[model samples]
Target chain A: MKLSTITKTILTTASLLCVNQFSAAALIPTHDSLVTVPVVSHQVERTSVHFSQPIAASQQLSSAIDSYTGISDEYWIEVSGKQLNQGIDLDVNHPQALIRLSAKQTKGAWLPDDHAIDPQDLSLFKNQRSIANAFSQKVTREQLATASIFPNSSAVKIAKKAGVGKFKLKVSKTLKSNQRYLINVKEKGSAYQQVLFSERQSYLAGQTITVRAAINYRERPLKNTKHMAFIKSPTGISQAIDYQTEQGKIRLAIPNDLPATKPGQLYELHISSQGRDGSSSIKRNGKVAFAVAQPTARMTGNVTANNQSAQIGLEVASEGRYEVSGIVFGYNKNKVLMPIMLSASAHYLQAGIQQVTLNFDPEILKSSSLIGPYQLRSLKLTDQSRMAVLHRNHVKQSNAITQLNK
Target chain B: MKKIVLSIMLCSVLLATPAMATQGLAFIHGTGNQTDAYSDYWTGSFVNSVRQGLNDPNKYTVINCDFDQFMWDSQAAGCLANQLTSFITNQNITELVLLTHSNGGNIVRWVLSNPTYDSRYPNIISKVSKVIAIAPSSLGTPLADAVNQGSVFETSLGWLLGYGSDAVSQQQVSWMNYYNQNWLHGTSGRPSLPVIFKTIVGSDVESAFWDGDSYCAGYQYQVALETTQNWLDSCSDGFLNCSSQTGAGTQWFIDKQRTRDSEPLSHQQSRRDCFNLDLIIKNDI
Candidate 1:
């Protein structure tokens, strides 16, 4: 059944309360049973057992176990359908097989691959996904449920029935209230399942707040496979929660609206996934930091001219930040110009290159309120799109500039 | 004593002379051919073409030095550095032709800039007759970030670095750091492109260049993740960027299919296209 807003808010509140919980099981959680996902279909050629799982944000995950296979196969398909049908005995050579939280959403992470990262490193939503992508390969879901943070602790370990796979975090004592929890993810070879991704969210016992985490691609919404915990103390100390919005954009959303939330606002950004592109974030020290959604205005546009010979233009390829200038003249635009090397002129797009470094040029094409758009040639046209983009990307003052006398 | 000294000087002169021989020509390597001799097929092909174009291999010893494709095999980068340092000292090296692949541009840049390499063979850098780069990593490639993740991810990300060398597995941190730290131009190091030297073909980015930072464009919100516009603006091919693509010469980015216009070529095809596009640069600029 669909959940009502009231229920969601309550659920959100409950999930918020779950942070600040810590478990002290120095032993890597060990599970009771085992589960192996088999390669489906009669086209069974060979399979590499994957032990995978999701690592919640603010959690650390890793593994030392090497590679092991269930059965020996005569041949292995190298790429999708292309195979090494030589009946060459295939073996799991290294300790590299495991399922992972691929992505919190259908979309992938900012970087192509992911890894187990420090919390501070997870501040960038993409970095969070990087850490998750790095760990999901070592452990699987089944392995986590039966495991434990402490020998008897359920925080790190998974229970037989993780309680309806409830979307909530279980906290511990080590964490102080209102502090953010940076989690990690890792894999366990000998487990109930082929792979398992896990997390351990814990914050202090001080001030606290709650928020929902989501993953997005373009504009489509995706699920948050994991949740981490943290605390924001009333002592003007707090962290931010990173999130993947409904649009697949990995965002570092800070609770700018919360009553007590401020720069010192502590937050734990919860992230999870089957491993494709699960999101996460970290701080400057390489620790995972929660992210707050920040939407800033970015300008995009072009520059153009009317004359036919030396047509020049510009475009802003960045956010609302820059300085632009060039000369047009007092009364009317008049002058001979040469092909400006974009890179040479910090403002220009340099030869055939674009993006790397930037420099805004003073208005090279002068305007005098007496002319049409600048022209590349007698017949050739020019605009920011076709011309060298730079200057005011979205905004240009005038188009009347004199063409260089060829 | 005078007789002995004269005899020694005469012997030295004799040893330095080659009978009825022409000057040694130059050989250039494609980008990132540093994995090893076998892994760099492009370099081998470049060697063959150079040999064929010149009609002599002995006169033009194409130094297939290690040019790590930015995978950060310190060993590979080091090996190339050491060997080239030696060649610069040992070989008479008549005319030098800097034929590089992707970041090979940076490799050559390093060679010419280093006093040990360039000073010993000042003529080599000066003789830099032509720079025929094959999809050189003039600009970095963002895709390279994946390569740094090591083995586990590589097992998952296969088709990534089409030119898979040991460097691909070498973490992404160093490569990024190297570009940010070292990549730059010198005053009199690399010879100016007197002749119309050219950069090869391919497309790299199309989707959302500027992703992590993006805005709505069409039905699906556009991403700054890796948009062509963004790449042209900030991101790079596995490693470098567009602004970095230019040098002290005439430059061009070819996309005959226009696919590169919208979607630039991934670092791999950018190389293969080098051969097909060879016809253009062979004679014309």
Candidate 2:
């Protein structure tokens, strides 16, 4: 799904950083909403390339970093000019290109660019001029990555000599002006574990269940990812399960005595793996949900029908669709009678009351006199889910003999 | 007036004699647990057929034992036990005969062998002179065993009268194996059963189904019966095989040589031989 243009504008403004010379309001809109930070330079020939579509600065930076190193969602700096001048400057009065980070971008945990590189060893370049940390304290290379104007001087660096990189610029810092710069960011992807049930049918709680997961690498070491499973019962309680992995699948039997499940209750299975890779850590999680099968079904209700009005209030303890069927008969003693079929209506029965209104054709009773006896024979209830009849009730001649005032 | 009083006194004195025993016949119909309160025992003609065949409506009083609950569990047995005791006491019955069919035979066995009732309802137990079980699943049915092993066909007759398959599955051969020797007799050895038990096994597969049968018919019953026969390793009466209908102790085999098609007793038509034997044989005993 594409983000609406209005949403993109709102997100862009929320994360864009302001430079010292430009007011917060002035830093918002530039050429197509790209923050233009002024670079320190003197009479440099500047050129601007216009693309048909306004490309997201983050996307461009991510591709550049990935092409150089497999690493993505890392900050990089890209300067259009060829020279790496040591002290080149830009006019501070002019509105120049500023570095911006997309609000939606996900940057991985803050860490030094290199495992060995310390905060003191970092360098910042504005138009190729290395600058000091605005705060007297040595800012970590990772800390100097973003542009913020509050402290007057913020870290700006060409960490990898890439033209597009992230920088934190202070509002107090002066630029020579008329110099173009670009600051771009790439959003990091989180490690994930996708869990799925091995079987397609609804399982009883005590039934043994097998699940499989696709583990994706993030910060966790490939060898040491500890797989674990947890079940959250219907009662908002969770406990770890002792699971065994065989042939790339996780299997465990749901405890037989799991607390009784309430109506519409669901048991959620959480499969996750955790590992620590020296200084980096990763926690991957996945989830699947199912309901527990009930052992017995209890039904309580009455099936009442007459020529004028008929209704059934059946409450089945089991869950699923059920069908009702019966036969209607009128007799005057030993005389043979043809059985009349009762019009049955079907509905899904849950754990509670299910009221159904039945309509019997008045024409079936038209032949008999109004003051005669009738019998509701073989009134049966069947569970369609299990494909079996659960209950049978017949109002025989003795009790069912009543006047059919049709 | 004096002559009428003298006639009434003489009639009362004759009715009170112990020689003219008031025998009660209880028909325990089975298999259709999903049946309603009034007609829990199959069709009305089932009892009528038995009555018509007995040809002794005046000699023997018949009562249909109806357990309204739909599940065939111990609860049904408990209900039957209570009804039996009540019927014996209320009807002033001196001798009672039990006629059980299908899983109803299990209910009778449970009541008789469950020792817990031996002391409580000694009268009802003592009053039972004989039990005539028709296609009784006393040793459990192989068809039930097949259902427990997961042979499910919706078009089959067992699926309709089975009541969610729970009742049928409970009567599986293995469960019945455990139930008969362990639960029934295994408690503290078999209780002293005073009643004489004779099981009538049916081996009529051809007449097992009828075209207009309300339960099931056609290729469905044929396929179900065929598959079930393979499980029993013997001939069947459409539902249970002959070996299962008769308990494991007695080996009653249908004669293969002199048998005619007319003698095969399917589960539904097991009552056809009612006239051949003396049902009220207690008078002779």
Candidate 3:
């Protein structure tokens, strides 16, 4: 078709703009830019009896310790009630109460003559009426020692099976001079609440990190709960993030514009939930830490393996030290993948394609009965200087190794 | 002639055997950017007492680094790794025992846990025999959260506390919990650390004004700790909760379990020679 000079000029400019847009789009790096070699099996053997069962990737991967689980089920109550002549009044609200008492000598006062108070000299009162058998069990000096000071700091657990109510603790005997006491009460048997991060342990920049909160009451998800979430940077800056309820779980996503973190520094996602179940108030706080890194480098998907070692190629965007680590897996007589050993190495490199070597020890191979045609599993490439994980692959089959000279 | 042959054989045998380990100690200070940790953070008395267990007292070094930054910051863990690597190389130390207090434990744990973070980390981990963490804020403390919350709590106590550093923020209970579950090791379900990390937990703070024991460490610090303990659990050393001190590594002993006279070690006293704490560490090394 014929066109005028002005129309041709406009068409030319539009075509150039389209080309520029395509170029820019291609330059932006994403997770797909990472070079990953899928697992490839060269030989297979079948056995009637399975010696080892396949392990799930979740179990095989390293995970964080869940030591603080059930922490949400406990809450601390401040001892700010009425002060009595000997002790103070406790307003317990949970089924179980752990009361701890410690004596702190005030300023300009000398140590008390008696360091400890006898438990037998303690009394419990409800509505000004003494409960004769309030004490669940007899507490000894050794149990008190576990709290702070032996014979000085004492703790007792009161089992109030009757449910939440107010109670008071009083000392029958008067304390000596300069021994002012402080009390702490912790209530247990609250709602069950926990927050967990996704299975992915590390994330690159421009990626979203997910956190899910499970708040349960009476074996069911708590309703009408208000959830708040925030991301605390390594530098202590807190930024609130938005969350949503998805599939009956409170899910929060980390923002895309997360600032780069220093080596060994982690960003924390703190989630707090508050709700009520039938006149009882419940609150829980949970947090999960994760590492975020700039995509400084990635594997090139080129691996050269020899009998003694395997060298992996990498394409770097920044000048820094890089580390490559992976577990070497060998096939047994039944063609089952068994982990042989883990090897890692690091080196400084310029912004270009580079190589790293993973040396396999001969003695380790001999003892494990490992041969060539091995697979590198859980292969990871980390930018040590930038402190970012750039690439990770589930499995990468090496170029073949049949035997070693040694 | 037979005696002469035996003597030569014995000399050869002795020469073939490797030399004994040259032991060294490094005293790592807690949060601030210390320039002279020997005199400022850990007094000469405490350092000297602990080093006496070594064959050569000169083999010890007091690390001075900007620990107020995050554990992985260049001035924090990086500075620590540099000084530790230098110590191991200069002294030809075959074995190293690190004595860290408070947040210092987290910094060292970073180097041990993420060995690939720096080129010097693997080397430092190899030469280290053990770490003795005293009153370590391993799981962190609620006091940090209270300070960072920065309202009435900060206005009333933040100035006196003066610990609003990055390290303190990182030690907020939830932040430390994140690190424990994700990055750090030696907790309940995490993988065991390559080096044995033994913790000495300070269970309580005693700052009676008239008592002589209260003045062993800085009385003002103990007083501040006593006030700050309101944000912590009952089992606290006026600074860190007992759970935090025993959060990461294996619990070596609590304050009353090992300290002389069964005296409870306050947060400040844990770094000093109060109640024979220095002697207890000395005997341990």
Scored by TM-score, the top model is 3
**Chain B TM-score of model 2, please?**
0.68
- lDDT of each structure? 0.28, 0.40, 0.63
Error of 3 at A66 (Å): 11
A256-297: candidate 1 lDDT, tens digit per residue: 453332221223232322211232221100012221211111
Chain B, candidate 1: TM?
0.51
Per-residue error at A231 for model 2, in Å? 21
Worst 10 residues of 1 chain B by lDDT: B212-221
Q: Which RMSD values do the candidates have, in order?
A: 25.3, 36.6, 14.5
Model 3 pairs whose backbones collide: A372-A401
| Candidate 1 structure quality by residue, lDDT tens digits, B159-218 | 222333433322122222222222222211221222334554443433344542112121
Give lDDT: candidate 1, residue B282: 29
DockQ of 1: 0.04
Q: For candidate 3, what is the TM-score?
A: 0.64
Candidate 2 lDDT over B208-238, as tens digits, reads 3453331222334333343233334346776
Which residue runs does candidate 2 get wrong by more than 4 Å? A1-406, B1-18, B34-46, B52-75, B115-120, B150-158, B186-192, B207-227, B248-262, B271-285
Shift in Å, residue B24, candidate 3: 1.7
Model 2's C-alpha root-mean-square deviation from the true structure amounts to 36.6
